[model samples]
Target: MNSRAAQLQAFDRLLTIMDELREQCPWDKKQTMQTLRHLTIEETYELGDAILDNDLEEIKKELGDVLLHIVFYAKIGSEAKSFDIADVANEICKKLIHRHPHIYGDVKVKDEADVKRNWENIKLREGKKSVLEGVPKSLPALVKANRIQEKVAGVGFDWEEPHQVFEKLREELAEFQQEVKSNHKERMEAEFGDVLFSMINYARFLDINPENALERTNKKFMERFQYVERKAKDIGKSLQEMTLAEMDVFWEEAKTMDKRF
Candidate 1:
């Protein structure tokens, strides 16, 4: 078989297995969309974590888990007479053909930016009230901010220079500092949020994903903390027994080790 035929066969096999499991397996038979929603989210995050770690094997496993959730949801929808796997797949296929007019039709795009602009324009033509309407409210704030900024930029609303973003960042930071000095808890919280928003916007100006960058820092801190904990154990000292100066010695060593990694 050709590669495409082989892929179809593989997908068919998964479908067959899904049907059998739904009918025969007690746990699989019992699952509903509501019960599986959190699992789907967790699987997506695992896929993201795998990508961040550069672990292709884990990514593959996580992807399979996510795919299973997709099929499972389709199965449930079929049971409700709403939709099925073929409907799900064909709807996306239709969307791809609709969105990529440069390839599927005569629409000319100059570059990737043009392609992105076309995509947002297409969404608008498809009857979306606002570009931001497509963004899920459940998305984490950092990711949501990035999406909002990108959506606006797609329609030509953005700062022209990174220096302009830097100016905004400095202003937000100064406001936050003033709030800190004033010691007004509610205003301080609001100013702190403004600081974070400005920082995320500046990071976007520099082509940095704030969410990914923060997650990477979180992982680095986790690894360095584990290293410190191990060293403390070797010296028969709990973290509580160690002074800040002593922990700094291990923290510095961990930094050196991190460079090697």
Candidate 2:
């Protein structure tokens, strides 16, 4: 096992470097919590991209970038005579001990689902107004819907099985199609949103992260499209100059090389 004291020393080194940079580096001295917000979000996405690509080296670098942001924020807090890095770390540490009664106390849990239930129940006891209140409002719609469903399901407010979710999805889709045929744009939009929300809920029933799954499909489509473009170049043609039939030959060939196949 790793030495825990060595890990603390490594973090202390980061804090020391942050201190030096704040005092000496012109750009570092200027950043505030508000100014760093967008950069932190961008760094987070880069880390996500590295994870999805399965590039361990890129993952390490992106993780460092995000860690730097954490230390930076803590340093800013220290400057304002507020909570610092130690406070941030200790707060989460205390929360973990509070939330994980199975480890920290005598509470018994039979499975992962029971643990999740306990976690939500513990939050309610800790003064959270609602389980849904924990979901970030800025989350992408599909991901947000999945999270909302999961939070409510923790308290037993959910369909019993995947088939019921699928049935609800089909109902929503039918309503959307009816509105489309009627050419009622506003009603169609509302119905379309319902269809999407139902589909996300169904995805949750399948134990899928809809956002990650869709991004994976998006990556597959991009790779196949790029391959089709390369094949067209080899044939002295461009996509704009080719008929659908001509382009689809390359598309089909690309599909044969797909990772799943």
Instruction: Quantify all predictions' global Cα lDDT against the true fold.
Output: 0.93, 0.93
lDDT of 1 by residue, 1-261 (tens): 369989889889998899999999999999999999899998999999999999999998999999989989999899999999999999999999999999999999899889989999899999999989989999998899889989988988889999999999999999999999999999999999888888898999898989889999999999999999999999999999999999999999999998986
Compared with the true structure, model 1 gives a TM-score of 0.97
Worst 10 residues of 2 by lDDT: 252-261
For model 1, state the Cα shift of residue 207 in Å. 1.5
**lDDT tens digits, residues 1-261, model 2?**
449998888888999999999999999999999999999999999999899989999999999999999999999999999989899999999999999999999999999889999999999999999999899998878878889989999988989989999999999999999999999999999999999899889888898888888989999999999999999899898899999998898889889899466
